[model samples]
Target: MSESGASPAKIKKLDPTEEVHETREYDPETQKALEEIDSCQNEIDQLNEKASEEILKVEQKYNKLRKPNFENRSKIIQRIPNFWVTAFVNHPQISAILEEEEEECLHYLTKLDVEEFDDIKSGYRIKFHFDENPYFENEVLTKEFHLGSTGDPASQSTDIKWKEGHNLVERFRQRMQQGEKGGTGRKRPLELRSFFSWFSDHGDPSADEIAEVIKDDMWPNPLQYFLVPDIEVENGEGDDDEEELEDEEVDDNVVVVEEEIEEVDEEGVEEEEEEEAPGEEDGEADE
Candidate 1:
């Protein structure tokens, strides 16, 4: 239509091909239902987002409160000499699990550190540092625990290694010589095995047994302290009640069985008495 375009070059149309498809038109009721569903979904999404934001805020507040408290605790522990030793010794549950020979060596313990590697894999490394001791040449010993995907301690793997100190190698050599003379040679110090075993044993324990373990300071996880509530107090009472109920049920069954046995005995005695009476009457009549 333009003066220089010659009728707009004849407008071209899109020819329908096999790939072309028609759009479906839903009925009024179905369209309304779909709209309602979409509205509900949007509402749910909004509520979830709001809830997550609130939860995050609460978690942030908790962390802010926890940080200072933890710092203060660390300061207090640092100020006290032999604090770790005293803490472990004072706890009856922890003391009971340790060997008598280990008590002296644990006194030399200067530091205990636990590190977690969650990025590469789920695992923990426990490091223990001790002062100069006559036992082994290693001042620092590390034990690692590699956990499964499910975080089960029963399926964990462990590795033990140590760094050599100045006097440890010489002391170990002397011990080996002594042991060789006595016809008793050891590959490693028994103390190392004992310490590792104690820690590893706590990884998985019976529910009742684990309660005591978690209360001790030796438990590496600080989160464990606040995360697990004191529900065991009520659970203990419930367990006692269940035990009492079971005992009562057993007693009731025993009483029922005894009553049935007494009834059978009484019936047999009555029949014997009836037969003896007839014999006596017949004998008297003959006389």
Candidate 2:
């Protein structure tokens, strides 16, 4: 459906000079494949949005603290601003193929460095896999630096020029952590320490190799450990119980002291009345 609520125009028949749109109707197996492709594309969209937002936030924060400079900044601070996830548009060719034949298309958008992007004519690839067989394809798009500036239409590839320093793995890990924390609406607590051990062991062959050779190697866990509220709650509960007990003791003492004072006043009043009675009798006798 179009945004105006009108039915969208269907793609016209393929031209021989243009990219061919596959027109085969899908079998049940093909439908299943298409669904998987849709799912992956949706995940890719979500990752792109999250990575962009994270990068923007880091840049905004840094902009507030220090002027943008290429030097004298710590590596961690420098790295935070590079958290952008690559964005991808599904190959129109793939879409046309799906519409025609109903086959599932499998492809992933990966962030690329300048060198990597240059190698691919921009960082995009369309890979079609059916059963165990795979076919790889490419489409080229032109890029313009400024909006409204017309460039020779000679260069447009749907491929993205991957910006340098954009780390897909780290962005993916951060995204997964967010989902694990609360993004999925399940609100599960994530322990970064456990992830650190698994990630460090599996990926860093250099570190692992060094550690294996050393007899007394103790590697620091890289995952950030945050204090949970349960420990503080337990301590607070103990203090609250003690306070309640003290309040109860103070209330009991207040009541007992009030009763003792009332009894003493009553005894003093009785003695005063008895002395007054004797004085009245002496006055009557004198009269």
Q: Candidate 2's residue-wise lDDT over 1-287, tens digit each?
A: 12232211222355678874654556777666765665666678779979977876775566445432312232332243221110011222112212111121122211121111222221212121112212223222222111122442122223322234433334436665775431222222233322112223334332332222111121111111112234456557558778999999999999999999999999999999999999999999999
Clashes of 2: 11
| Candidate with the greatest TM-score versus the true structure | 1
Q: Once all C-alphas are superposed, what RMSD does model 1 give against the true structure?
A: 15.5
RMSD values for the candidates in order, in angstroms, are 15.5, 22.7
Q: What value does the lDDT take at residue 262 in candidate 2?
A: 100
Q: Cα lDDT of model 1 overall?
A: 0.53
- TM-score for model 1? 0.35
